[model samples]
Target: MTVVVTPLSGSEKLRLREVFASVQDSGSLLGYIRTYGFVRFHLRVAIGKCIDSRSVSKLESFIMENGLLDRVEGNANVHRWSEQTQLEKGDSIAAGHMSELSGYTRISVTQNNLQELKEIWDQWGNETKQLFYGNYGNLPYLLDVQIDERLFRALAQFWNPAYNCFNFGEVDLVPTIEEYTALLRCPRFQVDRIYSRAVNVPTFWKKLMAITGMSEQWITTRIKEKGECKCISWDALKGLILTHPDETKSVDVFTLSLYGLMVFPRALGYVDEATTDLFHRLSKRVTSVPAILAETFRSLGTCRKAGAGRFVGCAQLLLAWFYSHFRLIDKVVCRVFFEDYSLLKDIIVSTRRVNVPEENWIALLQNLQSKDVEWRAPWMIPGEILYRCGSFDWVPLLGIWGAIGYVPLLVLRQFGLRQFMLATHGLTQSEFAYRGADYKKRVGEISSAWNKTCRLKGVAIGPTTTLEYVEWRGRRVNDNIPEPDVEGARPMEEYLQVMP
Candidate 1:
């Protein structure tokens, strides 16, 4: 069938010309609405950044030139390719793929109630099939890149089962002006690498407030509200922890993950004080990391079909939380927190019975051997994390949960030729990793890294090397690393040797 294009009618043409005139005259909706000079100027930067005159013209032209305004063809002609091709294509291609992706990424909800939710989560780390962000892309790209299970297990190499939401609150670095601006600036604001990093906050209070208001509105509305439980109720989640240590529903986990994504960044000073305090209080009430893992392990027998997405996603939160909250050992901290040193030691190293698979159990133990913090400093590389979790004597550096008023602890990881020589009677690349290069620059850079928002690298390497921990006075801190002893602590090689 041949389709005849309708020309813009006189009246329709006049109306469109008028709308276009207004759109260009103001350069924004707020402007087109005819706000006062003060308000217009305040929103000018935001308006310019957000408004796409070219796209708006395309939209207007589509309605007039295609007879969409008159509904000549109604919804039938709407889907056809035209000047606004991307709009229709996005509806089918982007939106359709997103929904399909959501289905694939959703946790296989085995049971509706908390009991089955708990079981599925316990049997696996999470109740869902969505283990990683990339899982959505997995099904579509399966022919090209086979999803690897070992890639998921890498985090196991660094998990400390002892440290979850139970006693931990997500601590994140404050976003620097540049990082904050990078997040806030409109996508069209092209940054010249040479001078872009220098983008500073507005000097005037009104301007700053306006910018912040825009940011808050933008951040708040970006994610759609599920209208379900915003977070696991403190009492309900806590009960699950005491009565059901090793299981959790994916919904609760995902809710808390979203909650953290919004709250923790603001806590780092991205938002108002009231907002920060409210989120901090909420953080205290949610489930702990250890508790989540416990429930996950307990349910492993049943949720065999579950995906790794939720587990990996939430677990990364803990890693980033641990690093962002890292504290150097101070005199007062050593005296007050470690006063009951023996009690602390027993809690971590005491022998206990666990029902997890041998390999997984050992991997969790290895994760505790070193905290694989999500954030990294400038001078740091993976190997330079000095050995704080010495196979024999070192204590695993546990994280301090802000909600519980726990103190962040750091410990010295000092080992020389004698220790290195005894370990293998040979030199290794690990020996000189932490040293060399400009130390001051490293400290500055690491400090700078901490000021950025949370970025988690959930991979675990079992050397108790902390990427960054420094005092406000700029002194390097050495708090004791949390090195708890698991019953079957042995070399990774030993575990592998007996594996196959």
Candidate 2:
């Protein structure tokens, strides 16, 4: 007998192929394709994405195709309430209460009661067993489950025996970051901004951990240092500021230094003489002035060698110190290196240029990004002009120095560069590279905003936008864009592009 199987229709085969294609498109479904692909069902996919109007159609189709919806029982009003509800599904006490006592011989009417009890037992008996037995091998669970402490309890009050299975005292659950922050009105979880958030205990603890990078030793040390004054962290630092009221010495010098080394450069309105003083005091406490000076010199030398120029990291620090306390920096620089080196000469030249306006300063920095060592000496020229301008524009420029120059070099040397970059980038877009078209748009926005600010402050600023002297101006006045000869003038695009 020759037996031949009929070929599948073209449309049927196409539909099957389409179903397989959809299944394979889903990564999860494709993972089990070889084993589960043969047992195909349309219900699963339809239910997954179908919602609202779509969901109604899917349900209707399912019911029509399955032919079960018509016969299925609808509502039992399971949410309904009654006083008889005291007889829970599995409560034997309820069954007993409902039973009637007979005067002579009692006839059992247990059919309904047995059925209800069976239903209750069937529903939850396996659940109870599974809960207690599933992970009994786990020591913590086994000790609690295996031991029948209630059976061994001594009698108390009127009872001959007392059962003591449940512990009644309130449990002190560990606080999560959110819980702790909420309690303290501070931010404890991951955040893009900390200044606006309230610092809580958990947030405080986390900050302490991040700053100290210690689980036990550093915390203990801080606690001892802080004494009963406060907890050992930024919160403690703030608390000290609140409590001491007089002594500047107790102000968290370490925190100030870390803040100096970490945050200020990337954020605007955060740099100030007060914060700088705090940083200075902190650094002096942690590292001697002479040591700091030495490191600064060393860093300057390294940058000089790297062809990145001298006034990058440590040099900037040195300059910052000088700016902070001119008399002090002058006194120290003259006392230490005046006789041997032209370091004082260079500093004096740089100091003379400190009065330059912020826009001019930023322009100078943009110029410095490309120029060689020879072009850097002229940097002091812009600084002198700025100083002459008596521009307190120095404040924002300090942030640029800290974020772009000092912080990058500092973290890179320590190799914790990623976190350093993350913190800086989170503070401001300017701190990170937003290259290409995004960068152009950002620079343009910044330029316009800055011009508006300068105008509002009544500060005299040269035009930021240029009017090209093109032949297309056929209507009236054809004037060329006026260009101001700032110390280091570059093309607008060149001036705006951030250095990598």
Candidate 1 lDDT by residue in tens digits, 1-500: 54344454443343333233222222334333443343334333323323234434433454445332222122122212111332322211121221111111122212112233333334544224334221111111111111223322332332211111111111212112122121122222222211101123222222322322324443343322223212222233223333533222233333232323322221211222222222232222321222222223222211222322333122222222222223210111111112112211221121222232445433433333222222332112111112112221111111111110000111112110000111111111111111247433433332243233221111122333332221210221111111334564554333333222
Task: Give, for candidate 2, the lowest lDDT window spanning 10 residues.
Answer: 155-164
TM-score of each: 0.20, 0.18
Error of 2 at 44 (Å): 92
Summarize candidate 2's per-residue lDDT along 17-43 as a digit string, tens digits: 223322322123224243242323532
* Candidate 1 lDDT trough over 10 residues, lowest sum: 415-424
lDDT of 2 at 153: 15
True-structure RMSD, every candidate: 26.8, 37.4
lDDT of 1: 0.24
TM-score of 1: 0.20
